[model samples]
Target: MGGRAFSLNTPPIRHDVYLRLVSKFTTLLQTLHEIVRVAPHAPEKITHGDIDVLVASPLRTYTSEEPIALLGAEQCIPGFPTANFAIYEPEIEAYVQLDMRICPPEKIEWEIFYRSYGDLWNILGIMGKRVGISVNQAGVRVSVEHIEKKNKKAAMVHLTDDPRSAVEFFGCDWEKYERGFGTIQEMFDFCAGCRFLDVEISQRREKITVESRRLRDLRPLCQRWFDEYLPKLMGEEAGREIELNVHSREGVLEEALGKFDKRLDHDMLVGMWGKDLFDKEMWRRIRALLPLGTKRGNIVVRALAKRLEEADLGNGEYGALCESEEWRREREANWTEIAKAEWRVILAAVQ
Candidate 1:
């Protein structure tokens, strides 16, 4: 919500139109960038709603470019790390949307992998959650220490942002995937090919809508997967040896942690005392204890950090400290027994 917003009225284009547009657009983009690629569309995606393209440009410099002048786009909408150019097509007399995504020069491959194949992310992301893995724009992450009480994202550790890691994790041959699929069914098979995929768990409407979008309205690819493809695969995947987290949300996190070097980060997020999460949580409770505005709140936090560092104490051990006579005398911050008890419960997590 805090990020940039741009409204676009570009419409879908036929496959033939898309094919022609991509080539011409590629040539135009090359004039401005050394690395420019049209993220491949999903197989059998005959009518494309937009062209998702990525370019390697540091500082997200491409976001400011006026594609309207260069490519004769009808309008250009600027966004952070992305810019949507509505290309005018005299043939269809409609605007074809072309989105230029900016990535670090070194991350073009990962960006392309993330942006390619329309419904591919939705399929993998939905299935990935059930198996304690997360495939996002950021990269391939494994849900290492999710406590379930907090957002699942809090516990995810980046495995790798490289495309190879994802294909390997999903049990697909990278070369073939790079070559692309000819049909949507082929793409589905590739995703479902992952050893951990329990087709039954994946097909469930409840599991598919794991996030806030409950009573889900399925996207086109997902709609077909739920209402069609998965049902067809039931017989084939019936006797399949489903490994890890498919039947239950267990041990796979530890399994992933054992593989990656993110244990220290995982520990901090799950509540290693005095870390960022612990510091933020402590600051939250302390702020509640003393109803201070922004300016005073900032001063109190700095002072609290100094006190804790000087004492060689963790924030989790400060609940009792907050209730002490010295704390009240120094900061004029006093909490009632009710507040102190509640703070103890909150601090108990990191303690």
Candidate 2:
């Protein structure tokens, strides 16, 4: 609306083709926004009749089948969608798909392929890790090995297969191994530097944990509590009593319980407790022993804030990618209010 005009073309699109086209277009636009850090300005738009795509004027046109061509267009590009696995161009940072016929969500193989690519790259990028690549007649082979500490032993490990597999093997119970090379962050770092063995491998390895150690450690604690303590507390004696335990002194537990009660009060009044039913007394006691101000709360809040800030509020300003400098500036015009609102919601939950 600001500088671009949208146009629609009335052409008959098969139902299947239309769905694929719409999905691809969305991903393309999102990727561009992320890469350019600017909103996309479509001055000329073109779309066949009744299609979901909204193009701006000067009228750029391309078929839904031609994903590469669609992605390369200057004004319009695809962006991320809620449920599709696709690649992003390094230059524009926009999401792209080479084949709409291949539904990423439905095709488990394709999903596996894309996810694996993202995973491999992440694992090879740790601080002293070197991901070595060699080209052979068969295919490309990439490998990473490093010395890591486990139970007071420095052991060398090999991760020479697909990144997705490495992540699965190493990060499955990451808290147990992340003190060394077992983390999604290591996986992401590996992905950022290494090329995919195939397209499938890259997509599977999309997300990595940079500071995963904290969560990794906490994961075991939660698991142990759920598996061992829950039953013991219930007096049903399930698993064998292990030497490892969480500090559960009555005084500390009582203090934790008190804090939990305060937070629960805030949460219930603000409607944050709808997701789960927690015992007020138990939570207060747990809060006493647990680190109260960990960044876990902030992480959840920031994630929600970022999502809301980028969401379209139906202000008739659709098609503008917020990552663009221009769009961000415009958003910043009212961004503070939105941010404050999100902060309030998150703070209430974490309290």
Candidate 3:
């Protein structure tokens, strides 16, 4: 769902223009025998601002070479298998923001299942929360503890891998999610059938005033999706009773901090103390302990930073965190304000 945003003044492109851009990239990937599929965005829209594509190859790893070759260097936004870029459309004579997610051949089906769902995926994520199941790009985990035990890596469960268990757990139609829909209209119908839109609307109306601005942006998008798009697709209003309990923000933070403590204790027991080399995994573990923009997570981050500074990892990756300008810049860009402040304090003390 994360991608590069274009200039504020950028105009949206017509549906045909969007298709042309999709076709251009599809052809380029065909040469490399990589399978490509465009996500079913609002096909009925007059104009689109972005394109999302799923690319899969037999190769275990993917580089940005193919996308860079087609879209050019200036357009590419750096990332791992998931790359963001902008392509110039000859027909529209404008640039279209494109997000390309590269998946391993074996995991392509699950990737397609997740990527095509769009907001529906967010709805499923909410369902996941109710049942203590965590769903993300990697796959689904039963709990935050399970994720930490695996070092926060997705265990890679395919959709077909006992999906019925998940559906039954959430009390939804297993067949619908499995088979999906033939058309975008059918997909909208599926959303209505689940009464997800109704619950979403109710939740938004109730929480909009209290939620952060970042969360409020979705309100308009949800309104347009249902109020405008749904009625046009379904002809009638959709509503149903949803039996899910909502947890308070404080409760969520407490659960996250508890999980962080467990992970920290595990690391300490495994001798990840001061002797281990500082690497990307260590950096990720520290960042993971600090959930973005959360005071509690920032507290944990500060504690981890102090602990790391007191330890000795020789002249390993720890030095880069303080001395390397590039590393500092990247960390600052990715970290939240409180986290950046904590990290800077740690670096100052160590120096």
Candidate 4:
């Protein structure tokens, strides 16, 4: 349901004009950033929707608006490390869009590669997901067990910092990726070589589910792959193309764990230490120990979360006061008074 929350309708860029702007902006933005470059154009592409510019964040020594001013864009919709800028073109007498993506100094390289070749990663991500790995602006991550239905961020175990290595793990030749694709077909062929890819599963029409990502297949290059290449390949290959044991999500997750050397993380995830599960259990115990309503429980839990580690509780942080030796000793000494204390007295003491 969550789609791109912002959009700018602007005229497409002519290849010649796009080059001019890319050169111009590359020169201008460098004045304000250490690393600045445009993401690669899709091979054999003549016109483009927008100029995708990437910048390393914590701008060299300027304000967030510095790059917009430098590019001479008439308007900008600002975001952290991302902004949409529109420059007026005299020939078309309309705005041409520039998407500025800012990333960490360390991550700028991966971000640039990930954004390159246009929609390539989207296809790769679909292939990765079948194997329980995901590639995004951030690099490789293991999709941990069922925590996404609760907290998506906590559900991921970050695996590696470098995507080139991650890409190789998925079965693409690094040299081919470096040299770049010669034609749109060549790019598709490059994707076809990925070892983790199941041609039948990767190209399934029914698999286009996420609203925003579905936009990738709508692009001209991807549309051809879906409507033409895949169907023909499936028909010609006969029974060989369909996986013998269609990789189940569970099967792939286990495969990725061993392949990626993430077995220790898998053990922790299944051992009741996954953050979401642990917190849920901790809160259940907290509710019982405190015997308080939601509002008061929130205040107490937050205070507990904020407190300094001034005690010797087994877990460093106690799940409930009963887990704290100090609290237990106090309760044992004042059992008669503490057992029947009013919630107001408890709240006052905590505050």
Best by lDDT: 4
TM-score of each model, paired residue for residue: 0.73, 0.18, 0.51, 0.73
Local distance difference test, candidate 1: 0.65
TM-score of 2: 0.18
- Model 3, position 152, has a per-residue lDDT of 38
lDDT of 2 by residue, 270-320 (tens): 221211122232233333333335565346335544564356333333322
Clashes of each: 0, 71, 0, 0
* TM-score result, candidate 3: 0.51
- Across 53-143, the per-residue lDDT of candidate 4 in tens digits comes to 8877444467767767777888778886678887777766767888887777898888878878886877677677765678887778877
Instruction: Looking at model 2, report the run of 10 residues with the lowest lDDT sum.
Output: 35-44
Runs in model 3 lying further than 4 Å from the true structure: 1-10, 58-66, 71-74, 144-169, 174-189, 192-216, 219-221, 224-351
lDDT of 4 at 155: 69
The Cα error of candidate 4 at residue 104, in Å, is 2.0
When summed lDDT is taken over every stretch of 10 residues in candidate 3, the lowest stretch is: 153-162
Instruction: For candidate 1, write residues 1-351 as lDDT tens digits.
Output: 111123544556788988998898988888778888877788887777777778775323543555668888767777758777776688888677778787888888887788788767767677667667778778888764335346665666777787886777666678778778899878887777765666565445465544513312547677677667767787665656455334444666666556666665555545432244444665566766654456755665666657555654544444345445565445423323433444455456556
**Predictions in order: lDDT:** 0.65, 0.32, 0.52, 0.67
- Ranking by TM-score, best first? 4, 1, 3, 2
